[model samples]
Structures are given as C-alpha cells and as structure tokens.
Target: MRLAALPRRPSEPTITLINVVFLMLIFFLVAGQVAAPVDRDIQLIDAAALATRAPDDALAVRSDGTTLWRGEVTTPEAFAAARIADGAEVLRLVPARDLPAQDLLRIANALRMAGAAEVRLVTDRSAP
Candidate 1:
C-alpha cells in the first residue's frame, strides 16, 4: 500500500506583510514627534548652528513685518499682548529669510518688553 503524502503550506502569506507594515506605521507614529505645520510661503533664514527640531510655540514673522500667531495674521502688539497674558516665558521667533535684521531685533525687543524671558530665534540649518 502506498503511503498518503502530507500537505505542504505556502512559504509566505500576504497577511504577514500587511501586519509588518502596520506595526511599522504604529511604531513611527508613536516614536516620532509631531510638530505644528508652518506656512509654505514663509522661508526661514539659514544658520550654521541651529536646533534640529522646531519649537512647539513658534511665532512666524513675514518679510513685510507681518506676524502670524497660531496660524492667524496679527499685529506684533496684539501678539505680544496675548503671549504676555498667557504667561509665555519663551518666545520662538521664526522670521522670513528676507526680513531685515532691524525688524527682527525690533520684534525681539518687543517680545522682551512684553515679558518673555527668553526670545529664541529659529533658523534653518545650513547645508554642509
């Protein structure tokens, strides 16, 4: 009598691949830091040394001296007032690349006067 042959299983299933991809997606979402989105129109100035990550509470300043607070256009005075009222200790300023140094300094000064103990300027890292 001939012996019955055992059934063989497929080497790999599509479900395994899907599961691996899903796990990777979850890992990245949990491990990575989600930063607030910045306006595409605003170009940050380049610096030789700068922080690798963007600050959570960043204020964007346009070349024309316009300021964006929480994604809404606002005057510097208004922004400063709100920030002061909120008791923000650190003010992160992301100014446009074409913004004049005088303008940037003026904003920094205003923020200091508004009660920000530290005014951090955020700049793009220069290419090596």
Candidate 2:
C-alpha cells in the first residue's frame, strides 16, 4: 500500500519582524533630537546659572576668535547679511570656554546690531 506523503509545515512569518523593525525606526526618527553639529576643535563654556530658554539658532565662536555660522567660517558682516527666519528672534552664542570675554561681547554687539532682538549665551550647567 502507498503511504500518504507528510504535509509540509508552513514557513515562519517574517512580516511581523519587518513590521517591528519598521516601527522601531519610525520611533527613533520621531523621538531623537536633531541638533546642529558642533566643531570638534571648539569647547563650550560652563556656567552656574540655569538657562532660561533654548535658542532658536546657534553661532559658535572658537577660542582664537574665529566665528562659525552654521559650521561655516563667517564674518560678522556676512552673518548680519544672512537672512534669518522671520520668526527667529533669539540668537544663541556658543563660545569656547577659553575665549576672551571681550571677544564674546564684540560678537554679541554685532548680533544686536544685526537686528537680533535677543542674544542668549549658551553655557553648560555646572555640575552640582
């Protein structure tokens, strides 16, 4: 007598794994914070005072007094001429920890003259 052939088992579902991985990708894209890349050579200052608010945009100043606007080396005049977002009123200054205070003041003044309503100095909160 001929025996009936055994039925083959169905393949394991892979769609569930694909769905889970897709969901995780979406979650990370949504929850991860996107920040401007800081220059590797620059170092930021630390302050004891808490920041009152976050900055809308950031400008980095190196310890040697070179200014970086959006990661590109820029001058005060060029920075002033650069069109700012219509609703952007606050400009954040990220200066090197060793940068002279006088240079910081000069940059702040230039930004003010450039029509920034507010210039906030970004500093790290000192550890308690």
> TM-score for all predictions?
0.51, 0.50
Error of 2 at 16 (Å): 54
Off by over 4 Å in 1: 1-56
lDDT of 1: 0.80
Q: For candidate 2, lDDT tens digit of each residue in 101-122? A: 9999999899889888888888
Error of 1 at 38 (Å): 30
Which candidate tops lDDT? Answer: 1
- Residues 88-125, candidate 1, lDDT per residue (tens digit)? 77778999889999999999898888778888888877
